[model samples]
Target: MEQERLVLEVDVRVAQPRAPRRGGVELDPIDRDLEYTGSLLTLLDPLGLLGGVTVVALSLTHGAFFLALKTTGTIREDARRLGTTLGAVTAVLAVVTLGWLGLLTGSAWSWATTVVAAVALLAAVAANARGREGWAFTGTAVTAAATVATYFLALFPDVMPTTLDGGRSLTIANASSSPMTLQIMTWAAAVFTPIVLLYTGYTYYAFRRRIGTQHIPEPVAVG
Candidate 1:
């Protein structure tokens, strides 16, 4: 809702005189940027609104954790279960994404990015099947990053094109913030982003080792 409102507010395409013909961006004309953003927003809107599904699922999964310790073990078994589940989902999504890529290719978007995304997803599936958790994680990350990279590649010169007038579409040069603001943002990101990344990477590396159910300690009540 915030983004939709922002798009409606900041889009001064009406005043710009060159905006595309004012009909909604039709998938047929295949405006890659609009198609990508519209579809992504469609996916995200529900994900955001329906995020409580994760919390509910998490609550349910806690039972498995307890049962694991008392029965056949949980965390390690969950890891393998997750691997199988994610592998199946990834494979299915890969096939669907490949079909989506074919549509994107027909629409004249960058096919190279699709290839990268597919390869990364394939690597993830392979690694998951082989029980290489770290590699699988990296592959999944690469697939996600590649997809975002492709979105930008598809967005080329236009930042946001008004369906009312393609000519009025915002270009990178025109859409950029003032020089001073850009410089401040650049500096801020440079200073803080590396520190945050280092901290996060250290945490992941520290927890890289394996643990069996036997290693799990008993919970104690707090006074």
Candidate 2:
């Protein structure tokens, strides 16, 4: 199932590599280069690919930690083992990728988030080692948050850099909606955010119990 999903993802990426560029009025250097090359292989940016892999590793590690927290017996033991191994891999990949991004961006905010992400990942690994699954989950959550924050902080001010000489880059100032639109969005978010949060919290609370193989029903053979 995982392999099939990955294959489908790759096919989608190959078929619609420009999906990310849609709805953007201006092109960044990488996007412009992609356009110039017009090849599916051109989508392979080493740093970007590393970052993507790091995220995937982090997600897998997170899932393992979650399973360790919510399962019993052999399944929990397996989850712990898998989580530890994947956490180590995630730490290495995250450190390299985030450090590279921090240096490339050269911003205090980016560097700060990079450090936070590294520290969070380390904490998660340590927590998992100590059999503290909850803390491990929290740590991985923080790491994911920090990673995303670093990316956005690095891209601040200028949403996209100009590829052509003398071309105006897409900036937050240029890309932002009108004040009225912003106001409406702010009000709407304020009104709906709490309701959404309440619903999510209640949903999680309802299904918070741990489960094991014993909970599974035997499949009835239809003759």
What candidate 1 gets wrong by more than 4 Å, as runs, is 1-74, 94-109, 221-223
Q: 1-223 in candidate 1: lDDT tens per residue? A: 9999878777864443322221222321224343322344333332223323432332233332222223334564675465556555554555454444345332245467767766876776566566555566666667666665655666567555444323255669877999999999999999999999999999868865556667769999999
Q: What is the TM-score of each candidate against the true structure?
A: 0.60, 0.77
Against the hidden true structure, what lDDT does model 2 obtain?
0.81
The TM-score of candidate 1 is 0.60
Q: How accurate is candidate 1 locally (lDDT)?
A: 0.53
Residue 161 C-alpha lDDT in model 1? 42
**Model 2 lDDT tens row, 44-80:** 5566788899999999999999999898888988999
Question: Residue 1 in candidate 2 has what lDDT?
Answer: 100
